[model samples]
Target: MDQFRSFDQLRTNELSVLRHGFFKLWFELTDGQFCYGKLSYGNFWKTIYILEVEKKTWIIKRKGIFKRSFLINDLDGMNLGVVTPEIWSRKIRLSMNNGFEAVYLNKKLISRTFTLTNDQFGDILNIRTELWGFKKPFKISFDLDMLKKIPELPLLALLGVNLVLIKQAKAANAAS
Candidate 1:
């Protein structure tokens, strides 16, 4: 896959994260037609998920046995960033080695909508889950201007989706 220099190069501000398989939960990020990225579980326990965007691959895995944080690493095994969730709130913080930081949190306690915001860029992206779909795909809306400022916008967006999936899985397990 060829690398996209930025999200603006994709020529669209909207995308979707769709699940392909039944049991495996393979996911692909698309703009309704073309796939921009894909994600798959690295193990049966779902502790690790492999993320592929353009020509690059990343690994997102649980940080520790007793922690809720996740660590992101590149294909070369270099640590790229970390995703840490606030204990008493739904907000999650993404901190990268380059000093870029952002927050991903729900728009409302009972809503399926989520937003990603940066201190400098405000709200850069929004993700809403369809209420009627079996796949429950995430509809992503991006701020192109912010994309220009943050080169890692796509990676951050996908990571936010991954976090949401992790939370949903935990909730399902707890319910059953």
Candidate 2:
């Protein structure tokens, strides 16, 4: 995986996952995010329980109600701050996308995403994966207030979220 850094050369996945708290060091989207995770001591399933979006909303999916019959926009946030798996992802995906589309797999599942380097543009590292998929997309939702009570998360992976946010804010002002 490339430990190097550059601002101009960015990928869609990189931009999508930069603003995280758990992030320590990242190369790019192809290089899966595998820093120190606040994994539980137990040997139970350790998939990413929640995923944050746009540095604001969080989605915590239920035990079985994955994306079954829904659109990405169907996901909604809870009235309280608590994030559920159902409400955060801004489904930028399309039908027949490059992924397992047969609903849910009974066996253990893993995902590894990759990207080409700027110069060489070769597959360098394998990125993060979701242990589970949404059976029905509409099953997701969150409570906004839950965030207020929920202490800081340990799996706070940061994909340069702060840096990008600042840059975007600056660009917005410049454009305006």
For all candidates, the clash counts are 0, 46
Superposition TM-score, candidate 1 onto the true structure: 0.91
Mark the regions of model 1 whose C-alpha exceeds 4 Å error after superposition.
2-8
Runs with alpha carbons beyond 4 Å of true place in candidate 2: 1-48, 63-176
Expressed as tens digits, the lDDT of each residue in 117-137 for candidate 1 is: 888888889988887766647
What lDDT score goes with residue 144 in model 1?
70
lDDT of 2 by residue, 1-176 (tens): 13423222322222223222233322122113332211111113322223232223223322244532222111264322221212343211112222212111112222223211112222222223323422110111112332232222111222112222223356698999
C-alpha lDDT score of every prediction, in listed order? 0.82, 0.24
| Number of backbone clashes in candidate 2 | 46
Q: What would the TM-scores of all predictions be?
A: 0.91, 0.19
Q: Which ten residues in a row have the lowest lDDT in candidate 2?
A: 133-142
Highest-lDDT candidate: 1
